[model samples]
Target: MTALLLALASSIAYGAADFLGGFAARGAHVLRVVMVAAPVSLAVELLLWPVIGASFDGGAVAWGAASGVASAAAFALLYKTLAIGPMSVLSPVTALVSAALPVAVGLASGDSLSALAVAGIVLALVAVVVVSGGDAGGVRPSREALVLAFGAGAAIALQLICLDQAPHGSGVAPLIVGRTVSSLIVLTAAFALGAARLGATRPDTRTAAGAGALDSLANFSFLIAARHGDLSIVAVITALYPAATVLLARVLLGERIGRVQLAGLGVAAVAVSLLALG
Candidate 1:
């Protein structure tokens, strides 16, 4: 029950982060946004280290660093895809792919679930797809954009799975290490893109920093929840983040909440309840 609640919280945080990050991505060099976001996220991880405990064990550090590499790739691919593709298609497809990989890994590793939990997972997935549906003004994404979305989702799944591979005793230390590595990687990428591209648009430093902070919070919740619960279940619940993202868009951006999206939100609530009971 506790894990379920934590997972739910993680979903909300992740959604909020996505909303901020997506908003910041617009009208800037993607690397500029990422560079600001990475360092801010690292700061958040550092702040949490004291409260969450930390140890620089070899296994933890290695796994965390590995995940950090994947994290860099995910951020690059996902943001670029969003810039090129329709949000309606990119978001749900990426979310489904990211969630599916973790669930597959969990089941293969012998994580078990009740039938009720399985049903909840199914509905949760449906909710992600349904909630992400919105008016895109008839703009279809290219095949290249679709491919990038898949790559981004795979990288995200890999990032989280590597974090989960860290030794439990290492606690938030892995997260700290991961954030540092990712920050450095993003910083380097920003530099590699050269100053002309970097200066192409005025950077939204404030929004990017908000994205960074929220992203770290979400990742922390996800790491803790996965440690305590079945990965398959946790991943599915976390994937429901799109619903939260949609809700946030409706409230913050005054985006229209379509009837299909509203129905998806209702289904998400019932799915979450069933998962909690299971």
Candidate 2:
């Protein structure tokens, strides 16, 4: 139950981080932002290593690296998708991909859900969509963004699977490896695309740095949750991140949350509570 709450909180933090990161990345050199943020995330995680006492295991390191690869791709694609699509559609769709995968994997692993729990999961999923507040207006989502979003979802799913299966003795080690590898990968990709040179003179760098720190903090919080809880539940709850992101948008970006989304969020909250109880 406690883990579920942590996961839920992690979701909110992650969503807000992502939105801010994406917003900050706009027209700026994606690679440069990644370069600065990834290393910083790694450093922060390293500082937490002593507190978490993450064990060093070959299997855990390997699995974490695998997850890192997926995470690297997920972030890049998610950013790319957000760049070209309506926030409402892209955010929800990408989040759905991230949320749905763990549940599917859990089912394949033979984890059974009660009827009530299933209903809750369904409601939570719907809430994620509503929270995205997708552009119902006349604006169309870019095809490229859609494609990238799909790819990001697939990658995130892969990351979740790897994280779930990773050795459990020390969550910190795996997380450190994951963040370090992910940072390197992002840096490499940025170099390859010459994206590091974009917006060289802009102040968005500060925004990206702040977002990265928050994102890294979210990752740390989630590691604590994931270590003690089922990945299926953790993933689903984390998927609810859009709710936080949407709320932030309302507060910071002056975005509006509709009645339907508010209802969806309420229903989803109840569902999450039920799921945690189960």
Candidate 3:
């Protein structure tokens, strides 16, 4: 129960962070937004490290670094695809692909789920697709966008798997290592590509910072959740983040929600209930 709650909280935080990041990216270079956000996230992880108290060997750090690389690649590809594709199409595809890989890994590794839990997972997957909508504006994704979206999803799956490789009871040290590696990679890439400019204005920087903080929190929650729960279940719940993002848009940005979205939301609630009962 605690693990499920943590995973749900992580999804919500991730959705909010992505919303803020998307808003910031509109006014600044995507690389710049990432570069700025990474450092802020890293700082937060550093602050939490001593309090959490980690115990791990070099193998954990290696796994964490690998996860960071995967994470950086995932974000870069996702942002690139979002720039060129109808988000309605790209978002659902990426979310589904990301969740599918983890579930496959879990099942293949002999992790057994209850019948109710399996049903919940199936519904959760369906909810991601329905909630994401489908070419609402009738814009088709370019071939390049579709390819990038798949790549991003694969990278996300790799990131989650690698994070799970960290030794048990390592506190947040693995996250700290992962964040540091990702931050440095993104920063270096941004500089090499001439995308290191912070922002055209201070507000952009602040917005990026807020996104960074929330993203850090989300990652922390996910790491803790993964430590306590099965990877398949945790990944599915976390992938439900888009629902939270969409809800926020409706409430805060006054974005209109269609019947499909509402149905998806209802289905998502049912899925959660089934999982809890299981």
What does candidate 2's lDDT look like per residue over 165-207, in tens digits?
7777765787789888999888777667663455454427677
Q: Mind giving the per-residue lDDT tens digits that candidate 3 earns over 1-278?
A: 98799989988887777667766666456777777788998899888888888665797799889988987887667655654545545666677788899889978877789999999999999998888674445557788877887898898788888877788778887778888889989988877776235545332888788878887888888888888888889889888887766666567655556788788878888998888888
Arranged by lDDT with the best first, the candidates are 1, 3, 2
TM-score for each predicted model, relative to the true structure: 0.94, 0.90, 0.91
Candidate 1 lDDT score at position 222: 85
Instruction: Give the alpha-carbon lDDT of every model.
Output: 0.82, 0.74, 0.79
Model 1: clashing residue pairs?
none
The Cα RMSD of model 3 versus the native structure comes to: 2.4
**Which runs in model 2 stand beyond 4 Å of their true positions?**
136-138, 195-203
lDDT of 1 by residue, 14-89 (tens): 7777777777787777788788888998999988888889989998999999989998888777777766656555
Give the distance in Å from residue 215's predicted Cα in candidate 3 to where it truly belongs. 1.5
- Judge candidate 3 at residue 207 and give its lDDT: 75
Indicate which candidate wins on TM-score.
1
The predicted structure with the larger lDDT, 1 or 2, is: 1
